[model samples]
Target chain A: MNMHTPLMSASPLVLSVEGLAKHFEMHHLNRTLFAFENVGFELREGEFILLKGENGAGKSTLLRTLYRSYLPRAGHAFYHTREGIIDLALAADVDIALLRRREIGFVTQFLQARPRVAAEELVAEPLRLAGTSYAQAIEEARRWLAAFGVKPELWAAYPSTFSGGEQQKVNLARALILPQRLLFLDEPTASLDRNARHALVSRLAELKAAGVAMIGVFHHPDDVADLIDREISLEVKTIADGENNVAE
Target chain B: MTPASSMNAALERQPPRLMLADPILTMTGIEKSFGDVRALRGVDVTVYPGEVLGIVGESGSGKSTLLRMMNLEDMPDRGEYHLALPGQEDLNLFTLDRFSRRMLRARHIGIVYQNPHLGLRMNNTSSGNVAERLLMAGERSFAVLRARAKESLDASEFPISRMDARPSELSGGMQQRVQLAKAIALEPALLLLDEPTTGLDVSVQALVLDTLKRLQRERRITMVIVSHDLGVIRTMADRVMVMRNGDVVEQGLADQIFQDPQHEYTQQLVHAKL
Candidate 1:
């Protein structure tokens, strides 16, 4: 058996992206944009991968494509679970809300435009979507926010009204509250200062210890030093030059 | 050069301490208290045009509060904040009327927040965020704003292609660079940066500092950058102000402040780091 076979049988990889590709028509350049081409990586159980790249280098684009905010024109993404390996690319689009609510959690730097749900409302969204009762969702929200180091006084405020740092914490709270297996962060530390960055890092480590696999696009190496287990570098050959095939 | 001059030169690699004939923003006997807790007491600073001033202090030392004072967001209960625009006008910012103060902040004062997202509009495109202050500054034409945004982004080496993506879709360094573009697009005479490079990685931090200095020189914009990284303060600050217990512990040129720190606190801070 190949090396991956046994490892998969024991502790399966939480997420894997193989030959992931997204091509968009860029009107400004009068050509199609290859956002990701043959981008291959595997995140084992509890593995933290820091996806590093500059702006326009497809960092946030890849995160969005992975979270299925935008559909990848071609290629594959899979989430390996106890049941079996589920094709994330298809699950991401077909069962978008359920997929996002059940297995995937994405924390954008600005938090997405999911509406100006109050602190309680937004935090409770995923679990409620997963069919949790309102009282249970609110209790979960309160507990998660406190666990994420957010103050109780700001619980009723809209995410739009909170400060950038506070809003990010709310995003983290919402994405992480449901105990999803795969977590994704795009520039999560962009708005956070040093102390807050440290606090989030420590919290992420705790979640990592609890067997949550995360894919993060990190800019500050120091802020992400202890969080990442692998680094992915992007070259033209990866996103422009096609090289690999999708694996089953 | 002789050995004496060589040693002297080695000791003082940069120029002597910053001395201006007149000050741009001066704080005298500024005292601020929050109920019973004294935040700032008898703190003073003298800032000049085209100068990079670094404010260094630890947590709870009221450095953040002092920066808030610069933006006039938080006012000192005692003392005066005298603002002078050389060759143009001189006025005490503390004495300005509400409309005058709003006008000054909207047009003259530009602040780069520690969290670029807080200062930037993330929902709109990058060009929209960049031209936001220009809209605030009464530049209403869409064409001119777009042109100005392109020019500012080009000047700072900001990736012009990302103009359509919202702040949510950019890297940390990219967002910070966008904030710089927004702040400098107005070409404000005074720029205040609060922990601008604290969270950035070392390489990105260097790039940001270089960009800050380059903009300060090209635009002749007076800068006050707050940071805890002494190396950052050393590289960018013309004059470094050390704050402790909500007061100015020491103030001098970067060389003097780093080499021979007079205050025990400053010396300790230096030793604690590198």
Candidate 2:
């Protein structure tokens, strides 16, 4: 892990995950799979940390656990918020929701949308939830969409039918619209073309400069080589040959 | 055969008076209170798989409170709340900690409220509201979650064309549909509906009830419905229990209760509905 000095004076701790572990039991098959074990990390403000792993190595699993999508079997993810430090792993639903709206954000590989919701409203949802005026939220959503090279004609169109790359742009636009203290990006650039990838990198650069902390997974290291301050690799646990195993 | 012999034979085939084919929930001596107000007192309820059990009473009669306790929304002051999910051992819900109870509820129990605002997120898109339940169950794939959301919305008869609209943007009936879609998306073993159709227009209420009945039969989901409207109970429930002053005054098969109420309170309720 790289412990680099911050560009700003006295940068605060943004997040820390301690002894994070997750395991799944397939009851029908009567076998257990250890996704990740004993993983620990700390992130300071404005640092971009890259997660590296091969398939089934639990890179995505770790990200999902930290984001509250999957409950970790063991661990504490402490996030520093305006209200003080909170363990996201144990945070109540309402508390997690408030933190998601104001302090944290996630941009995944694909965008999920209702069939009839237009792209503009989808991207503007976060801002509106944070008490932004409807008009201003729309204005900012359009600005980010334009920056990501989404066509104006598609602004009012539903993103569900958009091409993969187009949908990804809208996802990024929505996640980036708010100035989150910490962000998680899972393969965020996989569907983007060359130009769009570069645009995303530049936008990430701006966020890093603004003291945003990020933990990300990218298909290609070069896509975010300049921004990554540290790298962590996960290993996929496999059973030894001819070992007897049972989930219970 | 003589007439008395034939009647005895039919009685043997009838379902048990206080039991069911399979019991999903069995509670005993349940009691709850909010300071001075006794919400529930010494209540016992048994819910069967694929059966709609109606709990009818006026407000403060503990009908809604009983449903809330069963789903773990609020803990009873004292009592046993046991649940028997398919393929799983019987679980005493109150014995577990709050977090474990919450997790279990998310996976096996779903609850809908009378007011749309209580059950639906007013600002979230209908799809978002529906997908949130799946996300709570540890679903990580956005595609799969969204697809499940659409399926539940379709099952609830919500318009596919307006899936993206927020609750505020939809009509009251449409908003209730979104709430139903969200609850059913969990495929919960026990569905708790608290006055699900109370606030809607009579026509809209009928539409919502139709969708609910269709889904109930298609999914074979066990349900406990609490309603002040006796008509709603008559239309949806297979078994009926009447509550007064936080106690069950009468309980029986829906047909029997409708045709012949045994208690004065139940008689008054039946008369009022008529």
Candidate 3:
């Protein structure tokens, strides 16, 4: 595990990614694109690490890879699971599903939902999955909505039809519903206004205090700059005919 | 983490045998009828947590009716029913109010019908149909429901790219998978299946069965499967209950029951399969 952050404590390391790499094959063009290579990081409990880089820097790819959204082409992501340390890259799909359901949480920039599902249900899902009673889960969803300043009237409205900012609020609320041990947030506040952003920051702080480890990519770093324990930058790698051209 | 120390810890942490200690659902003298036809007659059942219980019988044997009563889709005409949920009493479901019963059903029980059409909304988008149960369970956040529905669809091995299409647009096997995704989207404690793979082709049946087995084992879901196909029961069930003409003929471990059936009906059922 690479301890590049001064904020590390005796708290157990939740995730340790070593020499992780992601590459995409363009079969149509008969070429390959190396999104990132030799990326490594260690996230301890309660620490928040920020991902910094310009567009096309593979920042999102790195986040996605760690979250197991995209399979890593190489290396290991050792996660401290109830079953002990298991590599996310090599773990069975069933194991990954179990971890995602109970241990890990993710918030993405775009909101993807079923058409016509009400907003409250969206927020209550995580709580429900955690075995909370339906009434209690919905009640908690209502509480989160209030915290984010989502209008009560829109509680029954579908997030799929909501404005970009409103949808992001729902995304943030859903991700934060259950107390996650590890959280990956990608531009969670990109569409939020001042008040919502502040609310998100405060909620994130509460999670941090509760010893939840987090890795995030923020469009506005100033909003959460104080909460960040460390920073990792991913340089874009352009490959032509199997040759890598690194761009800093 | 040293290998020797970790091995010792793993041995110490091995879960105690929970086979029959925790009863998730218990039914005594359950009876149901459909007008002139008496579907179930004083049937008793006890399901332990994390155990797969199979109910096997032919059509009109009341196996499906028993499943419906367990999940509260239909009320039992006579008998006491109790559902054991964590941190709560063994709830007499018949005594609870309709709304409370509905809430419990949404939270604790998930059922997949023989016909996917009955379980899924044919007109709605695939994701919408999959998320319908959560919506009904009082989840009001569309974003969460949609995201969970998509997640469930992916987990069930339904193509993610086609999640936006209508259920009617998908093949029969795909539709069944979608319905399975929808049923378990809430991650309910008890999953009820009534001939879940009956209609699919043999190859598709194998695939669906593989998916179901993996899901049940991964989630540790307590399942009550009612199927005419003894092969399904043999593969998926830990215990087998043989039902005939609304009456339970015999009950025992799947291996024992299949190896040497006690009841004549069970013998015939096993013999037919052979």
Candidate 4:
């Protein structure tokens, strides 16, 4: 077990999660599958925490739960917003939606490209949604695409036709286009080539300098070892394990 | 000088623009039934100007029924419908009589169906079909109608060489373009599409949808599209409403629906597509 003490920072706390847990009930099998339990962490502005675990250890599930893509069974993920602190696990749908619009961003492994929308537009969409003019947004998208080593000619092509690496580059460009206060990245570099991976790391470095809080899972921990403030390793809990393990 | 601070500054400098402007169409508590079957339950929708709102669901989801109500092709059993077109901001669609409704639809609304035969006259030339819509909008003078018809056909990317060909003579893709030319000829404020590219070849579907997207952007026409094809909805809509068994399961910005669907039914639909 590799555990490091949390880094002391002066920056404001962005997220503080406690006793978070999630489980899925399989109706047909009459089984309760516990994805993860007793997961907790704290992240401050500009801090990067790397999530580590073996396969089926629920790292992705924990990230999704923090992002509110999956509902949690217990505990609180208290996020600090300009309005005030709110429990993400219990936040209203509309409230979560508002946060997603301006403060939160998540990048998964696969690119779910909309049919007929080009790569450039896909990258520019977040900025456009936030009210940037078409000209400016497209210009910014091109800049990001070029930096990520996507060929200029392919910028206008649909990402569905691209290779896995190429599509992941487009995905990264789109997700990182907008400056988010808190970002969740799940295996973002898994499909990236070395050049694109370097570009992504540099971009992430910039985000950290600007005080953007982030929690991410990476296949190669050494690539981001220098940037990580700490690591949170999740242990898999099997069905054979008793459910009454919570502290009284 | 950190990238994060710069990024935050850049975001701050952006002008605050509201995602939705004044709604061009608003329907409240819309209900409809066919004999013993309830096609639609109490539902409401508000469509903003210059935005594409997509309605999606499986067959018999009442998506088509709700769309028909918007186009005035079918009357809802109970609902309050309002149009915010110029000089008619306060117009209530239900209050209008049949003839008045027809005239209103002709002047302000355009619809494109999945089957070109439903929207086009197979006997008429492509230009003639387009001109017919212009003629109904009360335009006179053969010279003006002829020029406008050609312009609209060109806007839809219909081949100038096929301008005089009947719909039956054209390929399926070309026929769909002709229908598009006819629907958009009147420059209607609101355009409603029912599975606009459902039957075309994949390549042809892309072309047709591209033409529609260009026209929409150039003209800034508000659009309401109903399609069982999730890809079509994902491509064109700024907002999406998911329907299931006569109820709205979820509705939100397109990204929200596709990326982080909250409703169980919506998640199933999205996952099935993936």
Candidate 5:
């Protein structure tokens, strides 16, 4: 519950998550495990902030909750602007959907299955959400992919057969193609090779310099060592920690 | 009856001990593509018995794709794979049918994905997840299965007390231990691991990699590992294959490859990452 104000080196804060709490209820049992408790963080436009934690430390939970993949038991996500903040939780699903189109990008370590989508269509999704026409979105996505050395011949391929590294690169290509004010990358470098990871880090650095906001979750500290402007390290609390403390 | 019993009997009869001839697996002119996107265009790889092969490449270089094809998990669109089974004639792995291919994967090829949870069902107990694959592959009897699973899990250094705990209840390292237990329980002849140490702590990586090396030595498993990390490659691989742009740039012993990479592309790749 510390307020992490922006540093002098970066742009003003672009996105903020406040008082996030999540509880997971197992289907077979009535027991509910608290995944997160009042977790909070901030992302300045184009700034790289490392999210570090051990396994089951709620890092993934917090990221998933922010993306609306899992509904938070309680919290609000704020997209900051010059005059006011656009609160995602307060907005309707449609309104939030529009907001995602224009400002937010979520990249997962694994590809989420969707309907009849190729790499181009997948990358263009955020733009499509932002009210861009399909044709325009495809063009923009292709341009972005090309910049990263992804060839045109590969754009139409389904992601299922793509290697883990290939799929991850494609996933990154999608998130990064649009001019997003906010980006959340969960375990971005875990599956990537050193060269690819370096390429991504440099690309992210350039985006940060251009004032794009990002919050990256990574277990490998070295991957984000140079990119990170600040860090919020989570206490390594396992299931055992919770059990011992709770039982007492 | 097993698909190739006489072959198994021959292999069992003559154990290829310590630096055997001609290696266990060989891939030559293997090509794969999904629609128009050609993944591996003319790739050649060779893996020897008790040899740890590290496949290093940039993203989208077809390294992982190439490894998948070796296990028949991902089939090649063109070219044939000649597997050098110890006592049997060279088997064209591409010719195997679905059932046989799957059976082959169960008995001979096991892969560890980057994600720990992908292989194990999270809702099930540790022992359940560990035993489920083996049970499906064979070893259906309840008592023997449980005892076998318990013994294997313990031997993998994954604590037996948590054998009944679900994935959510286990730490990441413990969860990986669970996956390792499953992969080793079957005792596959070749193990395909993709970025096996990427997510774990350095200490945990050492533990897991050391355990893998030990198991590889004891079982004489030929490991075809895909890693982007050169440090990991240095520790695990006896021989290394350097791939780039969907092509093999260089292939040699790990020491030589690390010390003096012939291809400028490989040199750049080796130097750029660190």
Candidate 6:
């Protein structure tokens, strides 16, 4: 067993999980698939944990589950919120929403681009939702976009028309623009170039210094080795193994 | 001061929570049916002050039925509808008598329909239509009626110079603006909009949406908007309720509904929009 110790043990604990498990039941095929089981971890403020796993190891699924996008089949994820500690796995929808709006930020590999909305406006949306005036949000969005190496001319263009790399940059800028206390990054550097990756690393370093706790899956872990405090690797479960494991 | 105590003080001084504010309208266990067709089946909704709640669904989804119930245009077969206006006792809308309902609608509620023809009298001038609503709400003075009409018209971004023109003489978007002006002329606490920009050109729709957004922000009026167009709902609503076949499949903050829909039906609706 790999001992999971926080690099900054003095910092406050932000999240604690135990016996977390999730599965999918394929009704048509009479099959049950296990994504991950008995996954547990502890994270503290300003700590960055690198989620290491091979393909289909349920790394992204774990992140999404913690974000309340997917419900867990068993176990508890106790999130220490400003209001108080709550079991995120069983928290009410409204409580989860409040947490998402204020504390948690998730960045997926693909950007679900809305048509006709400019890149800058799309990136500024989170700030606008948090009650910043439109003009100020746009100003901050422009600054972030420039920092991410998005050209000035493309800032006003629709992200749906942008290339994959461009879209990822915009997505990164949008999610990173706001200083969320906890962040979940699902292969955020998957499609970026060398320069763009460097920009993202520096931005993340700044966030770490500001005490933002994060869990991320990087395609190439070497790019962020300096930022990583610990690692949790998932063991991929095969179909044959899942067939014997009944979903509880 | 100790660091922990100072942090606690900072948390104490945090801004008042918006979500904790008292709701302006609450509908519980709402049910509606038309003969053999069940248009709504046990839905509950709550609207906070100054927030825009968007109801989105395909045709026959009961979204329109729910919006109509808010304005008392269509009564629900069973439900508890309560309105809490400032400086007034909480009123149970379902129990109000006919006369009281009419008075309540005229004084405190405003509705803008999909078709401008349904909302505006063709013969009345734009400002006249607005003044007529004000008059119904007991504003008798000619000067006050005209002033209120013009003020609301200007707020809706309808040209003051064109306030005298009839609805027929105005463009589709302008006519919708006139209806908006008329609806808001009384400065009602609740505004119900049913597809307020459905048939206009995209550019015109944008103009009307911008006007509505500004009006809601400037006046802080609580609004419930029903639209089949996801784009319109996305632009206008702070929160969204997704319905299908007389059942509310999902309700959440707009960003969540649009970005991470949970239910399968909601996922389909979002993907269709995408």
Scored by DockQ, the top model is: 4
- Docking quality level of the chain pair in candidate 5: incorrect
Question: lDDT per residue, candidate 6, B187-261, as tens digits?
Answer: 888999999999999989988897888677556688999999999999888778889899877776676577555
TM-score of chain A of each: 0.80, 0.92, 0.93, 0.93, 0.80, 0.93
**Best prediction by lDDT:** 6
Clashing pairs in 1: none
> Candidates sorted by TM-score, descending order?
6, 4, 2, 3, 1, 5
DockQ of 3: 0.01
Error of 2 at B163 (Å): 23
Candidate 1 chain B weakest lDDT stretch, 10 residues? B11-20
List each candidate's DockQ score: 0.01, 0.01, 0.01, 0.07, 0.01, 0.07
Q: What DockQ does model 4 achieve?
A: 0.07
Residues B200-235 of candidate 3 have per-residue lDDT tens digits of 898788778867876764577889999999988887
Tell me the TM-score of each prediction against the true structure. 0.48, 0.53, 0.51, 0.75, 0.48, 0.77
Residue-level lDDT for A60 in candidate 6: 85
After TM-score superposition, what is the CA distance of residue B241 in candidate 1 from its true location, in Å?
0.5
Whole-model lDDT values for every prediction:
0.72, 0.80, 0.79, 0.82, 0.70, 0.83
Docking class of 2: incorrect
Report the error of model 5 at residue B234, Å: 0.7
The list of candidate 3 runs beyond 4 A from truth reads: A1-7, A240-248, B1-274
Chain B vs. true chain B: TM-score for each candidate? 0.88, 0.91, 0.89, 0.91, 0.87, 0.91
CAPRI-style quality class for the chain A–B interface of candidate 4:
incorrect
Candidate 6 lDDT over A14-128, as tens digits, reads 9999999876544334455678999999888999999988788889888987886655667888888776787777665545566776789998768977656789988998788
Candidate 4 residue lDDT tens string, B46-96:
787777889999999999889888889889899888988778778779878
The predicted structure with the larger lDDT, 2 or 5, is: 2
What's the true lDDT of residue A170 in model 5? Answer: 74
List, residue by residue over A107-208, the lDDT tens digit for candidate 1: 766764222357877888777767788899989998877766678998887777777778887887787777778888887778676665776787788888
